[model samples]
Target: MSCCSTSLAAARSFGSVCSPPLTSSLTQMSSMLDTAAEQMMVHKDFQAALDTCDRGLESLANMEQEDSRCGEVKAGFCILGIQALAELNQWHGVLSWVLQQYEHQEKIPAKIMQMCILLYSKVGEPAVMQEAARVWLHCPSNSRVTGFRTVAELYLLHVLVPLGHRDEALELIVGEVGGSAFTEDQRQAALDVVEEKEQQKQEPPLNPSPNSETTAHTSSTQGAVVRKLEAMLRFFYRKLLLTGSGSFSLRKVFTAAVLLYMLFLRLDPAHPSSFMWISKLLQLLKQMWSAMFAPYHQALTHSKGL
Candidate 1:
């Protein structure tokens, strides 16, 4: 059969399966455009591939509602266009496309926003990075998907830190580090900062004042600092439990659990509720650990039996 005839037959079959002509039409167009783009890329005709992606995007723009599948098709086209632009070394073109497609949209998908941020960073466009950061950070924190939140936080820290946005980076660290809004690297960075501060507190002051008033004041200040740190540690622990596996790092989660336990022991020696909370935390940890290792254990048992 001719390619055109086969494509029409496939479209008709898809239309029969997927209710509504509009959805089937969009799906067929997306499939055709994807195939054309892929063929062009295979032939090293990046510009042709880019053109195919543009056509797909135009079709997407004409759609009324952004259904999930349609949105996926659009995102795929955007990614392909960006890749083509990158192949052509047209960084500005990529940025322009991003601005046109996503910058002014009322509701940008988190995945698309992440793609734009990464693309801008690749092009060394700090200004665009800042705008992306502003849009993402201002997004409703409660409504954010945990995975997207984690990526956004990492991108902000990676791109914004060297752009002299230390204050913003620190704000993100404090606000999102303990929550599921951080990757393992970001979590490690936070842990390092906290550990360093803890080590500093443990070290004795270089100069000792003899006056009793000075000693008393110093002790009072140190106590307050310890109390604040302990509170942050507790918050981190609770948030970790509430927002499970944002970065999907079991190791980081285990490290956090251990660190929180240590901090609790050191900081809250006499609290009446300490034992109860610790008991609960231990039980939770046991359940998580078993859940994580159960598959491996089952496989091991089967292998031994064999």
Candidate 2:
């Protein structure tokens, strides 16, 4: 049999053994495989490409669990898998898979960015295109590789403006590209839209949502907290691994003592009680470090016990 024929049979057989695996484990494995497949794509081997595409499809088939993380992975894999199917002239599969993926993919920004153009072309659906525009406005500013502007333009002209959402469309245009990247002509075009909306309204512009910027700021803070917590846990794990459970030394004790000393610098501005607890924790930590390490240092030189 041809390699493609063998690969297709193997993919089908593997897919049929469908006892559900742990969602987290499956997601991690799928992501690892996806990254490896992406790297392997540089080789441009058709059989490998087919195998990679099949892996994505396999992940997509199992993505319907209640877990959001698994859903996100499935959505991503669906887009990638469909893209591969398209490249191979699997038109019927592409049609079926893209529709299925779109219906179930939870509509995240990255998936929207990945599949919008092709899906729009294939489906010729204005509503789906508008969704792509909505996602683009809220997508991260740094994600310029997505061509959000182009996607927005397609939706605005072909979908939103024609759907009698010209005013809403204008607001999105201003918010996305007005001040910095937009041309003078583009700015004027948007301003004309605002003026048009103003003529329809008796009052001034409505207040922007209080939580919009706050939500973005809070999201950033949460990301930082996660990173810091991960770093701390890794540090603790490494220390445990290296030190085994036991003891410490003078330099080690001194270093930990210095850390406790620095803890005093982070004073509680709100309450005196916090300061008291801070001092107490520091003292305890210092004592623990000293008890653990000081004897080790003493025994080395003087052969003395704590």
Overall lDDT per candidate, in order of appearance: 0.59, 0.51
* Most TM-score-accurate candidate: 1
Name the best candidate (by lDDT). Answer: 1
TM-scores vs. true structure, each candidate: 0.49, 0.32
- lDDT per residue, candidate 1, 278-301, as tens digits? 555566667655655676789999
- Candidate 1's displacement at residue 181, Å, is 0.9
lDDT of 2 by residue, 116-156 (tens): 44444454455655654565555556235344455555555
Determine which window of 10 residues in candidate 2 has minimal summed lDDT. Answer: 1-10
Question: What is the overall TM-score of model 2 with all chains considered together?
Answer: 0.32
Off by over 4 Å in 2: 1-24, 45-65, 89-96, 102-110, 118-154, 157-306
Backbone clash numbers for all candidates listed: 0, 0
TM-score of 1: 0.49
